[model samples]
Target: MKTEPDAFSLEDLRQRGREPWEGIRNYQARNFLRGMRIGDGVFIYHSRVAAPGIVGTAEVVTTAYPDPTQFDPQSKYYDAASSLARPRWDLVDVAYRHTLAKPFPLERLRALPEFADSPLVRKGNRLSIVPITANQWDRVLQPAR
Candidate 1:
């Protein structure tokens, strides 16, 4: 998933071990989170940085559940229309796996023939969570391999 370095970094995730990935406001991205199953692989990407890229891997530790942030009025992600009984937002727990030896920069991935069609590279695609095929995953890690 793409996260701003200022918000959350790979090192932060490693230190925490696992954390609830909340604050997803997009319906499509929320659906992606809902589709996640335990043990699903995830690429932890850093966005809105000088060198945006995938810096590590993580595993889905929990299935989708109501996002507590949506119920808390003090949270920046809180939704006034959401209720505890029928939350409009959902989140999943992701556990740190490993940091890549070298981050695969977005520019480099865009240049690759295999990743040309990737949702991450698609114009105006801002979904924080995007599903990646096994082949695409392997191609992304080829540099580290």
Candidate 2:
């Protein structure tokens, strides 16, 4: 889940094997976690920098739960509005498999006319977790021939 502390390179993501994705505080992210199912594949991507891109693949291993950070009042992610009966944050586990030797750069995806309407490659889109179509995944992963 934590591909990297500073920069999430393909190499870093490749090393995170079956780690639980946690510390998500955003409402949308929490909702995604709440709706997650086992074995759901994630296109582990890099963020928080200029050269962000899809680094590798990870499969969801566990279901959703209240983020421990939310319970701790001292935590920055803590929710004063949330209650014990209803936790505010949720997350899933993502098990790393392998990294693409040559990861399809984010720039490439943005340049494709086919991905003109794609949310992941869209300009100014910053959702950490996103869905990937099988065709899109195949296209992005196509090895040089």
Model number with the top lDDT:
1
Quality of model 2 by C-alpha lDDT:
0.69
Clashes of each: 0, 1
Clashing pairs in 2: 18-95
What are the RMSD figures for all models against the true structure? 1.2, 2.6
Q: Candidate 2, which segments miss by more than 4 Å at Cα?
A: 1-16
Cα lDDT tens digits, model 2, 13-95, are 45755655656766766777778789877777776656767777778888987777778889776788877798777877777
Lowest-lDDT window of 10 residues in candidate 2?
Answer: 1-10
Which pairs of residues have clashing backbones in candidate 1?
Answer: none
Q: Per-candidate TM vs. native?
A: 0.95, 0.81
lDDT values, one for every candidate: 0.91, 0.69
TM-score of 2: 0.81
